[model samples]
Structure formats: structure tokens, C-alpha cells
Target: MWPFTKRPKDPVLDPSYGDPHRKALIRALEKRKWKFARELLNMAADPDEMAFLMEAVGGVDGIQDWIGDWMDAEPESTLPVLVAGCHAVRWAWEARGGKRAKYTTAAQFKGFHERLRHAEALLQRVLAREPDNVTARAWLVTSSRGLGVGPAEARQRFEAVTRLHPGHLVAHEQRLQYLCAKWSGSHEEMFDFARGAATAAGPNSLLHELVAVAHIEKWDATEREEGNEYIVSDEVRAELLTAAEDSIFHPDYVPAGPGWAPRVATFAMAFELADEFDAAGHAFALLDGLVTEWPWQILGDPVEKFTASRDWVTTNRS
Candidate 1:
């Protein structure tokens, strides 16, 4: 028998929720087996599933190096070009970094826009072949921001996706980014968009968590104590609880594969911020130690943030 090796007691912070299919696809790509990746994309049950899998593909480092071979091998397939295009959009942001414009070098900005245009061209080709393609259209929404396409054009791209798949979570998330204050919007616009989308998506829809996301964004943009006050305000706390009930806590609500953790994480963080320890504990109980990097990482190290918050809820909850 092998030795029993103990693993570190850290919460595994994964954006993909350690999804089995995502793991398989990444392993296949690392082995240069594009066919396996192709099979995985083809097997996605719906547009949202496809988009979720494709986003994972796009984040694979150096996919640009060999994805062209997949494109060449499957000339008739839109999947390769779609995969490559999404990667380019993510690649564009990699060039831009996550820092504000003033902190970025001119060369980084130049590379950023150049890659976005390339991503646009590739995505456009995919759309030409399959106009109703939600994944390609969603990436274009992201590229529109990097390319400085006016809000009008961005809205058009987003509407195109909605016209096809109304409850598209990825597109809604991307559109939320476009409506953020750092982009072409104000906090008012961001909140308006978030509330409208959440209401429209209705009960059992993950989009309801967009309300939690909006609160997080506003808090992140405000001064420290003031942000905490805003999050813990009675009005905000009530809104978050209502939104959570409409989605995560609803009787019919079910967690979808790979996309479940982030939505729950958003509510968990929101409850923690609101100092609603009982609700926060309930959210963490649902998560059962799973973690996503966003709302938590926005405050501090994701694992540490998750551990601290979970511990606090355990200690303080009635």
C-alpha cells in the first residue's frame, strides 16, 4: 500500500468549481489531443453549458499556439474558430492586465486593442456562419469594451444574444461588466441594469444573484468604511435576501454543473458583508467548503477570505 499523504487544509478556490469535464478537456489539450476537446464542446447540453466550457478553454494558457491546428483540421466546424476567438478576447485582457488605464503602459493598451480587433474578426467569421451563436456573440460583447465600441454598439451585440437565449447567464454577466462604472456607465446605470435583469430572469434563475454582484461592485468602488456601511444597510440587506430567495433559496432552484459555485459565493459574500451571520452560515453550508475567486478575491486572498468568513459565520451565527 502507498503512504497516506495528507493534503493541505486550504479551501480550493476554483472559478470552474473543479468540474470534471473542464478537467478532462484541459488534460486533453495539454496532451495536444484536440479531438477530445472537440468532443467535449460538441457534447455540451445547451448554449450556457457550451459557453461555460468554452470559457474554460479560452483561459488555458498558450492555447493560441496550437488551436490553429484544430481550426485547420476541422474547416467545416465552427467550434475551433469559436474556441480560438474566445481565447483571443481573453488574451486581449491578458495584454491589458487588470490594473487601471493610468497604471498600464502605452504598449499594453496598444496590444490590448489589437488583440480585441483580432478577436472580433474571428468571432465575426463564426457569427457569419452561425448567426444565432450565443457564445461568439457573448465574447463580442467583451471585445466591444476593450475596443471602445460605443455603448450603442455594445447594447446591440448584447441584444442579439438575448434575442436568441434570453436567460443567458454568461452574456448577462458580460453585459453587467459593460454597464459598470469603470466602463461606460455610472453606479446608477449598473444598479439599474442589475435589478432589471434579475427581475426579468425571475425565480430559480441565477441572474437574480446579479443584484448581489451590483452591491459588491458599488462597495468595491466606495471608500472602505463607507462601503461596509452601504453593504450592511437595511435596504441593501433586504434586497439581497429577496434576490437570494428568488434564486438560490427557492424551492425549485437547482445548482447547475460548474456554474453553481459562483452564484452561491456571491450570496455568501453579500450576507457576510451585511453581517447577517445566520444567512451567511446558511450560504456557506450550501457551499460546503467550495469557493469562487471573485467577490472574495476582491477583498483579499480567496482562500483566506473564504476561510475567515466561514469561521466568522460559524463563531457568530445564532
Candidate 2:
């Protein structure tokens, strides 16, 4: 997997991979209950959920057709714009290449690029009309990533959103991707962004999740051997614990539904990969059989990968 493998897979990156709520979420969308759908999106406590909900609503070609009618009915309705725009970013991301563009044909890359532009066009239109919609700005961060924008522009868009809505976890998550080494960013930049973000959000905020995000990016930047070392290294592990103490493991810790599971999975996978089973067990306990198709699926079959790591930690615990 490291130097780049020939065969590539992952039939679906659906965020509903392990949660029950999303099954009902699909039902609401099928019935055209746009009000309920809007409620769900508004209630999403983090970016992963926002990304998932948008993909579920309009990741396909035909489903977003209703958005036009909705927009015509309510010119001020930013919901349709958000759905359509975020969907473009998701479609582009789903088509993106990985670790040296393995298995990504030229046609596929071009298509993904087109989707990024489509998303930008929609987001720009909304910004021109509404001008101050932080949701649009957040999706702009994602669209910028697919366009292969440099770190500075990405950071500017991120600041524009966070300046309006601090602790916007979804924007923060996108910022992590924007600052990753694979995307013209270095490890130092990624780690600095993560640390500063988590700190700014203060105690008891989900922003601390960026620590695990930084570790994941650090692992992504180094060779497999060195990367593994860096993840489990004393420095990274210490910060991970500090992050947990400041939020996840704090006496006041609270769950924000299945939408919050990816934050835990990030640590669970990291600790498991680092051979730190106990820490992984703590993460698993919080997971409570729930998961999200992220940071984990980025490796392979997400469920299989999660189970293998979870099983390894369980054996060590017993």
C-alpha cells in the first residue's frame, strides 16, 4: 500500500457505513422531505456529517434536479445552493486520486477537475448573492481542495468562514485536507494548523479532533516505517492524550450523535496502528459499534479495517 498499489477499491464511502440514523436519513430524502433534510444538515455538529449529508442528497447526477425548482420558488433559499455545491465537492473528492494517483485514469482526473469547477461556480454564485453565508464559504474550502489550490488561498477561505463561525468543525476538517502534505503542503504546516485550530476552539470543543487529524497527515507524509514511528512516537502520543483530556476524555464529554463518531475513529485507528491498544480501546468504547467511512476507509475496506484493528486491540485487552 505504501509505494502505491495497482488494484484500487472501496465501493462506497457512505458515511452511513455503521450508523442507524442514516438509514432513516435516506428515507427522508427519498420522500422529498426537504424541510427535514434541511434540519438534519443544520444539526450536523461537524464537517464529516455536512459532507455526508450533502453527498447523500445530491452526489448523483439526477437527484439535484429538484434544487433548481426549489431555488426558483425561494430565491433566498441558500439550502439548495448548499446541497448542490457541497455535492459537487463530494463528487469531485470521490473521483480524486490517492497516493500518487494510483488507479486514476486521465479521464477520471479530468472529470474530478470538472466537478471542482462546477462546485466553485455554484459556491461563487451563492457568495455573490448572499456574500456572508459561512456554509458556502466552508464548501468553498472543499472545492478549493479539489481545484488543487495552494495553502494560502485555502487558509484565506478557512479564515473567512471561521471568522464568522468559530469552531466550524466541517471547515476545520476541510482545512486539514487543504494543509496535508499530499496537497502541496508539508507536515509542519499541517501540524501547525491542527494545533492552532484545536487551541483556538478552546476546551471541550470538538476542535481537538484535529490533533488526531494531524497525526493521520503526519503518517501520510512519511514512509510507511517512518510514518508508523511518527504516529506512535512519544511526541505525537502525548499530544493525542492532551487532546483527549481537553475534550474527549474530559469529565464533561458529550456525544453529538453518529455524526461525531469519525473523531473517535481517527484516534482509534491511530492508536491501533501505533500499537497502542489501550488508547485504541478507549476510542472503541466511545465508538460503541458506530463508525464513519473516513480516515479509516482512506486505507481500504473500512469495516474490515476497523474490525481488524478493533479485534487486535480487544485481544490485547483480554
Candidate 3:
């Protein structure tokens, strides 16, 4: 499951699975702190934190059901609309098929399409009612990509959202996925988007993250033997280092509360793939011990792989 079940509570829940950021989101919803929750989420300046908020709410099946209650409680609030759309698109992402998987049942693909369409409808409603809700628009772009609406169309959706709320991390990353060659977007286009987005967003912003993600995804798209050497290239290496300086290593880099961990986690993984364990160690240190499923799960057994990667880095550091 792309959006796996919530960290299981039974049979001795792994402490490593207890993400503070995810906990905070659930707590906000449970306590009905709509304004506080939304305000807290708005501080997320990067894709890492944004993804955490989106996934924490959207990954679970029950969130869509909860959206009705939230809407009922705060009928005029844009938060509910954003949450509703985010949950739908995120769930649809899990259901959507990809070449990486050996098999995806037709039923699964159908469910994916249905959920994606539902997400699209919900976002459209949000836009119609609250025309300037950029988060809803971002989710709309993501849902559109999942629905296979084509990269050009997705770019239009993304650009429309950014025009309203510039430097939207989710919108940038979603468009990156839309532009991937595997999805019919070329490598050249993806890097250009990443670099341009980072440059536009400026330093100390997590927008540089697009560079890291672009490199990793492009590597995956290429042949394994050749791709293994992709990170070693002078160009890719230079971009990743610059991205690091502009974001994570910048003096003004702020964690934005518990949301900071994902930024570190993502950066660490990028460094790991680049064979720069020293840099990876810096990212891993910020994470403490909390590892998210993604970036690592992109390889295998998120927990195991993360722990092993950490151990290797630590050992080499000594």
C-alpha cells in the first residue's frame, strides 16, 4: 500500500514509527483546533513538511469520513476543503499503478481512478467556493497527474496555483512528478523545473528540495547500471551541494516545529544516494531517530533500510 495503514498500535508498536509531526496533526484534528491546525500547517515551507501533513491526514482511510464532520463544524473554513482534497488525492496516489510494481489488480486501478476523480471534484468545489485556496489547487494538480491528465495540463494547473500562492512546495513537487519521463515528462524538463523553482523560491527555503528529488527520480528512470553512476556526475553533484547550502545548511534554516524532521530525512537520503555519508550524517542528526516511510521505502523496508544506512554512516564517520 502506497499510503500504508497508520503505524499499527498493536503487537508492540515500534517506537520508531511514532512520528511527532504526524501525532501533532492528529491531535489538532481530534481537539478540533481548526485554526491552530491550519496555522501550524501553513508554517510548512518545504515539500517534506507539506508531505508529512498531507500524508498524516490523507494516508488513513478514515480521514475522508472525518472531513464531513469537520465541514459540518466549520462550514466556512477553507481548512476542511484542503484536507478533503488532500486526503482524496493522497489516497488515490496509493491506488494508482506504476511500472515499479510487478502487478496491480484492475480493481485496484479502478479504485485509484475513482478516488482520483473524487479528489478532482472536491478540489474543483473548493476552488469554486474559495477561489483563492492554493492548497486546494495544489491537490487538484496532484489529482490531475494521478488521473493521467497529461503533463502540459498538469503544468497549467500547477502554474495556476502558484500564481495565487507562489513557492508552494507541494505544487512544485507534484509538477515534478507530472514531468517525469516515466509519466511522459523528459529528464531535461524535470531538472529545469527543479532548478528554476529553487532559484525562484530563493535561499533558506525548502524549494531547493526539488533538486534532490529530481536527481533521485531521474536516476530511477534510467538503466540501473548507468543510473548508478548518475549521482557521480559533476553536474548532479554540484546541484545537490548547492541545494544543501541554500536550504538545510543555510543559517536561517528553520525546522518549523516538528515538521523539520522530514526535511532532514529527505536531505540525508539524497546525500546517501550520492555517496556523501558525511553530508548524510548531518541530515540524519537532525532526524534523531524518527524516520519516515518515504525516501527510504523508495528502496525497501523503510525502518530497516534507514537504520542500516544510519549505522553505515555512523561507522564511517568514526
Candidate 4:
């Protein structure tokens, strides 16, 4: 009797309906049921629903391609999907371990840098439309840093992110990195930043390494006992020595390229404080591996030789 005045479509048939299928797909994804979700999405009737389902199961590259197709079909659409795609790519990169991938050649680094730039540009465009988007702003800053943007530009972006969202942890960490690079030889500033970060972020291994590096740099430069004492607390020195020994045997922390230097330096500090022979031995072993793995042609023979020799001398002498 109310047919004419009734809603145009049955709620059950409405795409917004509980979408039992979508719910099931989301559940499967949450449970890490990749295979089931992938199968269901392939059979879903709605394109948008299928897109979301695919994204749930397929990971970053999949989402990027799916969203790219959607954009090609509907250029005037809002950017939620594209934004999600950018997030997926960023997550994928992070899951590979931030800035520590073992690249075979200079070309790979260039390619990675370009991909990071592309993601940053897309997020920037999104932020332009939505000025209050803190997540997009954060991603932009992180991507900019990943692309090796100079400290000044990265700091500006990080400062803007902090202004928009004061408690952003990643922005704070990135700022610390920028400070470290900017004041490379300044142990006081670097230690201050590292201590603040450790207090704020709570005993992160990376922050400990940063603090250790600052101390090691000072000690290496001045050959002073005060610098050595300042870098490694007695407790941390023991833990670091243990970690260095494990890393030497297992090499769980053999991050490639410039990444190795920080870990190596941290281990050296630990060895200095603990006077552990094996820890010192392992540090040089890993450094030697880095030299062998790194491309001397692109990275330069002089730099490689210097690093290799430096590691050898430090390990043997102390």
C-alpha cells in the first residue's frame, strides 16, 4: 500500500546495507584470512566494494593499482581512495625496514628515492585540499625525509606537522634526526636531543644508539675518558655488549649502507665501556661485510677503504 512513497530501494539491496559480504570480507582480513577475502572480493557485485575488499587483502601495490584504475575512470572523484593508496605504499616501504634496504646498485637507490617523492607529492596535493589533515601532513614529512631532503626542508615540514598536531611522535623523531645531522660534531646538542627523545619515546633501541653515537663521536675526536663515560651508562653498556655479540654471530642488525655505521658505532661504544673482546670483534666483522657488499664504484673506493680501515683499527686497538 505504501509502495509509491516507500524508499526507492529496499534497504537490504542498498550498498550501504550491513553489506554482510563486506563485513565478512573485513573480518576475514582482520583475521589475516587473505585467501578467503581475496576470493570473496573477486566475486562481489559492487565495484567499490570489490575495491575495498581487494585493498584489505592485497597489500600496497595492489591498492595503488586498483585506485589508479578508479581514478582513470572517475577523475573528478574525491581523493579518499588515492590517500589510502598512498598510505598502503608508505606502509609497505616501512615494513621493508625504514631506510635500510640492501640495494644492489645506485639505480635502485634512485628508483626508491623517486617512489618516495611521488608518494610525498600525492600527499601534498591531498593536504592542499584538506588543510586540517594531520595524517597526510605527517606522511608528507616522513616521505620527504625518506627521499633525503635536506635537513632545513625536512625540519620545516616537521615543524608544520607539530604545529598542526603537537603530540606527533614521528615528527619529533625526524626532528631529532635532523638535529643530529645538522650538528654532527656537537655532542652536547645531540645528547640532549637523544635524552629528550628517550624520555618521551621510552627506551627505544634507536634512541639509545643515537646517544651512544654522540658519545663515541666525541671520544673518537678528543680521545677523552669523559666522552666515553657520558655515552654508555653501565647498565646500557652491558646490554649493548650482549647485543653486539649476538649481532656479530647472527647479524640480526646488519642494515645496509649508511645504516650500518650507526649500529657499528653503537657496538663500539658498548665494547669500550664493557671491554668485551667478542663484541669488538663482531663490530669489525660486520663492517667488513658492509664494505664487501657495498658498491665501491658508486660509493667511492676512498670512502669504503676509510670505513673498512677505521673499523679495523677501532676493533683491534680498543
Candidate with top lDDT is: 1
Off by over 4 Å in 3: 1-22, 28-52, 69-79, 97-102
Colliding residue pairs in candidate 4: none
Per-model CA lDDT versus the true structure: 0.85, 0.73, 0.72, 0.48
Per-residue lDDT over 1-318 for candidate 3, one digit per residue giving the tens place of the 0 to 100 score: 012124322222122235565677667766666666677677676544565577566655556666787678888866677788788877776776443534777788898999988888877878888887666777787777667786678778888988877867767878988887766578898889888989988889887988998888878777887887988687877788889889988888865543455556778787777777677777776566677766676777777778877777766652
C-alpha TM-score for every candidate: 0.93, 0.84, 0.82, 0.42
Error of 1 at 173 (Å): 0.9
Instruction: Please give the lDDT score for candidate 4.
Output: 0.48
Residue pair clashes in candidate 2: 47-170
At residue 62, what lDDT does model 1 achieve? 88
lDDT for each residue of candidate 4 in 53-149, tens digit (9 for 90 to 100): 4333323234454456445554564354444435554554544443333533566556656667667666766676777655556666656655667
The window of 10 residues in a row where model 4 has the poorest summed lDDT is 7-16
Error of 1 at 62 (Å): 0.6
Q: Residue 182, candidate 2: how far off, in angstroms? A: 0.2
Q: Which RMSD values do the candidates have, in order?
A: 4.8, 6.5, 6.5, 18.3
- Clash count, candidate 3: 0
